[model samples]
Structure formats: structure tokens, C-alpha cells
Target: MKDFSAEITYKTSRSSGAGGQNVNKVETAVTAIWNVMESAVFRFDEKLRISEKLKNRINSEGLLQMTASESRTQVQNKKIVTEKMLDLVEKALFVPKKRLATKPSKGQIQKRIDNKKKLSEKKENRKFRF
Candidate 1:
């Protein structure tokens, strides 16, 4: 149920890509805006998390802007913007798996103690014969 067309607003700017005269003349770079409150792309909790996580990226109006000027063509810029938006959305959705608490095994503890005893023995042997 991801309707990116309605969710995003695009604005084009002059591109610096390798298009010779076309790059300087045509405004092909794409800048897209996603309205967090209005979009159907993210749920309530997801939007909240995204807002919190990307607080610096969001403007005072709570809009997320992504600019793509890497390519000369408008189509390519549009595609890049879409891909970047998707990546941001996916990153917001991800929850890191928690690590379980674990105690060292008896064998591991025994080996560590054994190693310490060996080290102590070696140091003791190096002491002056007084």
C-alpha cells in the first residue's frame, strides 16, 4: 500500500552531471519531499521513530527532503530519489536484535585459571634464588 507518487513532492534544479551543454541548460536534478503527517507510507509509530531518528534531517515543518542531482537526466534523478527514500523508510522500520546475557562456561573459566597459574609459575621461576 505504498503510494510514493502521492507521498512525495518533487522539484527539479540545475544538474551538474556529465551532459555537456544539456547539464548547464536544463534543470534535471530532482528534490523530493515527504510529508510525515500526510503520507500513507508510514504508520503512526514508524513516523514517530523516523522523526526522532532523523530529527536533524527533518525541517521545522516535519518534512523530509531528499535531493538527487547525481545524474543529468530527470528520470535518473527521480529513480535515485525514490531509491533513497525507500532506503530511509527501510532503515526506520528495522529493529536491531537484542543480545542475550550469558555466563562464561565452566571449561572456559577453568582454562583461564589454568593459564593464569601457568603465567604466575613462569614469573615465580624468574625471581632471584634468595
Candidate 2:
């Protein structure tokens, strides 16, 4: 979605999950790597935003990595990994709307106080007399 295809690199290895002998013979696992620091797809602010939001995923060398091995074919695995990587980057780039702090309205506050008073009155009425 962000035109990161040019900046991504892929590595393949034997898939570990399933496929028995086929797994041993073929390299279906795909690892997608992107160098965030050297990426031309994002501006400086966006780069910083991604780095900050995805700090755990990005290594010291500024490489963002994702792996996919569920598919039996290398091409399918590559596609899955690429999609995952794009989703990760897109999520990291998103900025949430800031929240504005405000006090409760006078009527709301009064309603809360009234509820508390009613509860207290009920509790007091439940007390046993000597």
C-alpha cells in the first residue's frame, strides 16, 4: 500500500511447521526484510514515527523483518510475508487522534452525587435499631 516493494528484500529457508519430506527438500519459508533507515518510501517524520511505534520489530541495524512459512510453496510464502510486512509498516505509520481532557458537566456531576446519596440513604435504612 505504501509502495515499499522496491525497498524490500526476501530470504527463503526450509519451512519447519509441516509438509514432512517436502519441507526438507524445498525452501518454502520466506523472510521479508526492510531497512527502515535507508528507505526512500517514507519521509523523515514518517521514518521516525515507524521507528518509534515499531521499536520492538526493528533491530539495531534498523531492519524490519517478518517471516511466513505456513504455505507449502515458496511463492505463496513470499506473498504472505510481503503482505504481513506491509501491514506492519502501515500500522506503525498510523497516528491515533489525541484526546481532549474535560471535566464532567454540572448536571452529570449532580446526578452522580444524587445516586450516591440515594445509596447511602438505603444503607442507613437497612441498619438495625437497638
Candidate 3:
């Protein structure tokens, strides 16, 4: 739901993969770059969360870059890259629920011990004895 239009910039270049003859003639690849450090739309906490969650995507200058070249036309590629960037930011802002540690139930622990005993007895019975 965050508006990143003002903070995002796009760069286009000839797509190296797919598109056959059109790849050589037209620049279809779109790279959408968003500067997380300078973004006015996000609060300090949100920016910190995004930087920590998307550390691999963010470059040294704190720019999050996403590229798309699946479509033959530049406009389609631009739209795809833009959507990808937005999705990335949205995911980065998500907070995961804390996991609680719990001990195994008594019945479950007993079941495991019973299984181990059964396996040990079975193996002992298989041994060659005179």
C-alpha cells in the first residue's frame, strides 16, 4: 500500500535473453531502482525493516533494483519490473509471528520410546544364535 512512484527510477537496455530479432533492435529490459535510504514514503522503522529483510537485493548505495525482460515490448517489461519492486517492498515490510518452543507431549514421547524398543527387539531377534 506504500506509494513508491516518487522514489523509484527506471532504466532500459537491450534485453540479452529471448525476443529473437527484436532483442537486438529494441531495448525491452526494464530495471526499476528504488532508493530505500532516501524514500520519504516509508518511516524509519519500515526503512530499517526493508533494508534488513532485503539485504541481498539492496546495493552498496542502498538502492533496491529489480529487472524484467520477459515481455517483448518495453512498456510490458516496465510494468512487470514495477510490480516486482512493489511486491518485494511489501514482503519486506511483513513481520513474521514469533514461534513458541514447546516440549513433546507425554503420549508422543512414550510412543517414540515404544517404537525404539520394538525396533531393538526386532533387530535382536534377527541375530544368528546357536
Indicate which candidate wins on TM-score.
2
- Report lDDT per candidate: 0.84, 0.91, 0.91
Candidate 3 at residue 121, lDDT?
A: 100
Please provide, for model 1 over 21-123, each residue's C-alpha lDDT reduced to its tens digit, 9 standing for 90 to 100. 9987999999999887676776888788888878888999999999998877899999999889878867876789999999999999999999999999999
Q: For residues 23-86, could you state the per-residue lDDT of candidate 3 as single tens digits?
A: 8999888999999989999999999999999999899999999899989899998988888888
- TM-score comparison, 1 vs 2, better candidate: 2
Q: How many residue pairs clash in each candidate at the backbone level? A: 0, 0, 0
Candidates arranged by lDDT, highest first: 3, 2, 1
After superposition, the stretches of candidate 3 with alpha carbons farther than 4 Å from their true spots are 18-21, 127-130
**Clash pairs, model 2 backbone:** none
lDDT of 1 at 118: 100
* Order of candidate numbers by TM-score, starting with the best: 2, 1, 3
Clashes of 1: 0
For residues 8-67, could you state the per-residue lDDT of candidate 2 as single tens digits? 999999889778899889989999999998999899999999999999989999999888
**RMSD, every candidate, angstroms:** 1.9, 1.3, 2.3
